[model samples]
Target: MATDLRTSELKEPVDVAEYLFRRLREVGVRSIHGLPGDYNLVALDYISKNGLKWVGNANELNAGYAADGYARVKGISALVTTFGVGELSAVNAIAGAYSEYVPVVHIVGYPSTISQRNGMLLHHTLGNGDFRVFSNISREISCAVAMLNDAHEAATLIDDAIRKCYLLSRPVYISLPTDIVQKKVEGERLKTPIDLNFPPNDAEKEDYVVSVVLKYLQSAKNPVILVDACAIRHRALNEVHKLVEKSGIPTFVAPMGKGAINETLPNYGGVYAGDGSNTGVRERVESADLVLSIGAIKSDFNTAGFTYQVSQLNTIDFHSSYVRVKYSEYPGVRMNGVLRKVTAQMGQLSIQAGPTPNNEIPQEELLSPEPTITQAWFWPRLGQWLQPEDIVITETGTANFGSWETRFPRDVTAISQVLWGSIGYATGSCQGAALAAKDLAAEAGADQVPRRTILFTGDGSFQLTAQEVGTMLRNGLNPIIFVICNEGYTIERYIHGWDADYNDVQPWDYKAVPAALGGRPDQLATYVVKSRQQTEELFMDREFVDPKCKKLRFVEIYMDRDDAPKVLKMTAEAAARTNAKLE
Candidate 1:
């Protein structure tokens, strides 16, 4: 009994619970995030024993959101739930993870296999005794799904689920029966790391595709590089940077790709979204003889509702698994390798895009500004105050659309669920992102510059998951939260109702939210800014975002209820037209 459990020499068979948790630790899980249920109580007993802290969230949906946020920063994250109800409550968050390519392992503890087979009704089930329903639903959203009924195969199942979560950078599902929680399983698989075999490209095909892309690059009179969200998801930011630098091609970022490439780069063009693009960006890209697009996701919000003018014939795409050059296609040609090859040979190519089209980044005009903050005045100023190494999470509201225009500082990782379009995401995601940043900062030693985890959310979105603020407080995480006080669903208003009562939300005292959410007064700082003068005083103050501050800060900024970013307004019009009947 006294033998050290941590020692690898012990080679003893361990319970399935120990096996599962230890495997997660080996793959870089520092903590587990979820709500506790009766089905998982026994499994929870082994959490602290394995040296992992349980991040008890206020609800399953928020737990899923937090876990997704954590996974985006930490490389992979796991969430534990119980049976059908708890797991189903997190489905929306899981879907968001899938759309955005965040690797999250969602584990569900269910009734024993004996009960399921005997048709015993379970509390969380629909009373139909059909245990396969939830798993079937999960299969649609997850890259991999495994339900473990046999102890002998549990190790391999768990390993497969974890590997899928990483390889695809998406959510994976695992079902664990209650009776199997303590079953004995082999521990030998723990010695070797998870075998994540990503196959290499075919030699001849790889060379052919690379040559085709390079030939276009050298011959084009105006070649443009377009970077999008996939560049961040596939871990190709470094390669994209090298390609842009070496080719000397003018680069533009899609809305989903706001923070992937540093905006300060000399050849950096402004944001491009068809009709919503910055001045001169759309014209330059559409006029190009060839466009080198990397990880481009053409979501509605990302492309201004598919208003793009660039043709497929002039576009050469570098995707995660394949390459598309004009009309020809090359499957199994990995982009990671292709990008490296293209970047290395850039020195031999001739430059084409002339004079490097430029536009002056917008600056806030303070003269005769509104008494209350307006969307136009605020976003630009917010960008001016951003610092290096800041982690930003924006919700799917005015914050999401407005933030696309802001130029981020160097190393600032901005996260927005534009493709998923989930409201209330930033509240829970900021909690997870902050914890990840804090954990990474601690690992970097005592002298590392502190990284800020900041959240920009609308009032309606905040109400959906404000309880997560308590989770942040409990963990002693310091994140700056800016709640946009626009009265209701402004984004929804833009799309459908201009003055509908359904779009209105109950107003609450925003400053008292922290205390109502169980945050101690001394542990938090609150601010309510109603005027342009006040907004400037707070964000511009160097002491407000000071790295030395140890308390979480919350700020509520008031703006017009109908106000929205110009790009979002345009997209909303397009969305309305799409929803309308034949004219």
Candidate 2:
């Protein structure tokens, strides 16, 4: 029998929605990202009441993307949507977050339990009235799912979903029924926070793995440390930095791990993406006798279309769940503990002089007389202008591939969906990243400069999520956005259709978009650059770079339709071959 709130007087009973929002606040979710739907409208009221900001996104998909970005910066985030239509619309974004190991709690609003019990057809549901179908679909991508049909179990389920999302570092799904939104649950549960601590590895197993890693470290003549996206996802970057600084081995990052290491370090080699790597990086990484690979995810894009040449016999792989030393496998042992122990116990080995990463633009491109903004000239040139601790976001286009050449300053966070390859993700992601940066800056007080969220996206991709700019403006966020106006999907063109009509996109006055999106003229700045000199002038502008200027800086950069970054060209050619007929 259910505990009737009207009949029985329970002490300190809390609404289900209030409990959920409070839990989100406890987990560092300062803002709730989603659009209000009819089913979820009442629940939205609890967001601000629980000390959380409600980010009303233009659409559900963009909301999901924004939540993903927030999670990448703030550790965890929440998204709310209506049951079927809204939740289905955000599926692609949720899938992308799952693919990239981002923790976003996707809370969906469903019809009342009474409606479902009577099999009544609902607006957001299928005609068959099966309420579980949507959640069934979500289980494919989500690490955990909580169906809140019963008020008794609602609080427990919500806690479980959120904990799994953080521990597993992936998306989770929660279904909140309309009638259940205000259902009374035990308020005392909120007093005890969810356990977010990772379970420690078995002491004996960890010791053995650490010793095995140490043995290989001492004997190798040439050893290198390769960091990847998982190092950031699994929160092992601190351990990675300690090992890199203490060991002084040649350190390199995969394409997806661009910002994991400090580029100023003496042992920091540039990105090592097989054929796409700078010649120095490829040769050094491939020739090494020993490689300490931390949290590596060698996807096609990450490895430059499956071109990584590192041998497994020479590599020691460290992962969140386990560590592999050469051919030996150590299961149930986590990387954080193993890496910490390995760094502490390891002795000195042969430390060779490694390549130093730099941001110097190529001499030929700098001296070129061409007026058009070429990829080769723009990427390295932009590197010179980037500041410390900047949050740089790149779309899955030329911007993503081109940015591999740019060496980042200390503490800069690079956000991109490289493995998922989701187009237009950067714009929406930029909104959440800017908000997170704003929150962080406030916490740091007036002494520290606020981190700028900069976005580099192609015109075609920008058109997909342009409405997100309006949301950013409404929130008073300051982000520097660059739209590469090449007139089409340059990446797809390079892959299959060079001159096909399918790849072409209609041109728009991108500079006029913010104003049309309701930005005040005084608060917004727009620019158009077609030449290298103009680009340089904009980069050096004092007002543009000033943190005090609280304006959205939007720039439209024009380049030839056929021009693409060198790395993009190589990777595109490889992708084409992979899609070609077998011999």
Candidate 3:
């Protein structure tokens, strides 16, 4: 059955670089962070020619942090750099993203096939000679890795790698050989959009686990639910709230899971940690007979370095699909649906609620009678400036303390890569979140309307990815950035105080850096405040919030670096004494 087929003229082949650029565009990635190099020249040229915005960083670590910040706001982030050195420098940030379950796409350019085959001393290559040094580094952290040796596999691999990352909520690496970046391919481009479906539930196992959990809940006089980072990262807040409501059980959130439940809720006890530990909340948790831990990873930082034991209590551990009951059985199931179903069933079994009466600190016991320049002063003032829909990103040191104290509005969102406790993640993440907020506003038909995106970063952290200010100006992102100028790594200084001089950094004119980076003077404003009045006056000013201004604002606060936040200092000192007692 050989019928004569009508032959059509073939179309011109598309440039491989252009094809890659278009694919990234289709995936909604508008910004890329990294330093340019010879190996990535072709892609860089195409990206610039096609009007894509590329953000250059001071170092690869900062680049990855910037991408992480961007992803926190934008839903996904991309980082592009030359192979080996660039990729290696960015590893820490990417690993932080992995630990926090943030989605990021990392692209690295490799040496051409000819260069790799010949034992040439390539730039940035170690003695191993193989240009695939990234594969080894990325194996443990990245959700998946795709190396493009053949031009035919480039498009498919890139698409697949991106899809896998989004699906798994982790970083994915794609290694593009220089030769493949230039080779043209003929085909319809891969256009598969990522699917973000929740992992499937195991009904039978879920039912069995639910029965066991119900028994413990019924038997225990006091039962509390401890929510951690995974709960918020997985967008399981609504489900968790349902579980809490149905069980009529008191709830306490981990520091990383601060805002998972409405802090204003009647059942909300407060945060549970050593120093930041709400005494009333801890009493409830400590007295509990059953503790249902949902999406809680037993990290040293979260569990007070495993100093708090859960072995004695009737605890049910819930992971992605597997669940284990202490002194009982381990069952595996889809947690999302299982949790929902169990909550619904438990709603029928009535349990008395624990005491969550609002507990306020006595004025006499407060840090100081007169408000001084401290995180406590800054937090409440900062809270007053927040509106619904505003996004708050905090760094590890002072920002973490601020996160503990600051209350979020229902419309507001808060984010930080706290699991890894990486210092410089917030500044870069703020840039990305600001960019994402714009897109999100536009998608919701709120484009052209003013939106607020705020970042709280330590002096040490702000320095890591400070160069992103240029990208913010170039993209016209208006975010209020507050550099907590304590003058050093306050968190570390409190913990170790080893070589205090080394911990201290010479203070810079925080306001001047943005101006030097080409930010419009009118749109880009900086302020240094030493008093609460100054902080309030600057933030409450009508001109600063003018919708028409569309400016990027910077505020710096000068405080005593040696005088750590009261609660944090107390905790650190207590921890030191505890360690001493153990020794």
Q: lDDT values of the candidates? A: 0.85, 0.91, 0.72
Residues 1-583 of candidate 1 have per-residue lDDT tens digits of: 5753444353667888888888788777877999889888888888888978788999999999999888878778989999889999999999999989999999899889899999898798889989999999999999999888887778889989898888788899988898988877767778889966556788888878888888888888788899999888877888899888777788898988888887777778878899988767898889888899999999888999789999999999988888999888888888988998888875555445532323223454455544778887777778888888789899987898888778777778888899998889999999988888876777689877558888999999999999999999999888999999999999899999889998888998988988887888778999999998898789776657797677889999898887898988999888888888485
Runs with alpha carbons beyond 4 Å of true place in candidate 2 = 1-11, 446-449
Worst 10 residues of 3 by lDDT: 3-12
- Residues 1-583, candidate 3: write the lDDT tens digits: 5532221221445656777667666667777778787888777877866656777676788788878777766667788888888888889989999988878888888888788888578778986677665687898899989887776667677777887776666899988778878775543554445445665666667778778777776777767788877776665667888887656678877777765776656677766764455546666677677787877866545554444545544687665656767766454464676677777777444345654523333344355655457665666556556665677888876677656655555546677765698877887777777777776666568546645888888888888778877778877888888888887888777777745787877788888989988887776878888876687688778867654458898888777676555556655555566666754
> By lDDT, who's the top model here?
2
Task: Locate the minimum summed-lDDT window of 10 residues in model 1.
Answer: 353-362
Candidate 1: the clashing residue pairs are none
Candidate 1 Cα misplacement greater than 4 A, ranges: 1-11, 352-364, 446-450, 581-583
TM-score of each: 0.95, 0.98, 0.87
Candidate 2's residue-wise lDDT over 411-530, tens digit each?
889999999987889999999999888877766787666688999999999999999999999999989999999989999999998899999998899999999999998779999999
* Candidate 1 Cα lDDT to native: 0.85
* Model 2 Cα shift for residue 221 (angstroms): 1.1
- lDDT winner, 1 or 2: 2
Q: 1 or 2: which has the higher TM-score?
A: 2
Q: Give me the overall lDDT of model 3.
A: 0.72
- Cα-based lDDT at residue 89, candidate 3: 89
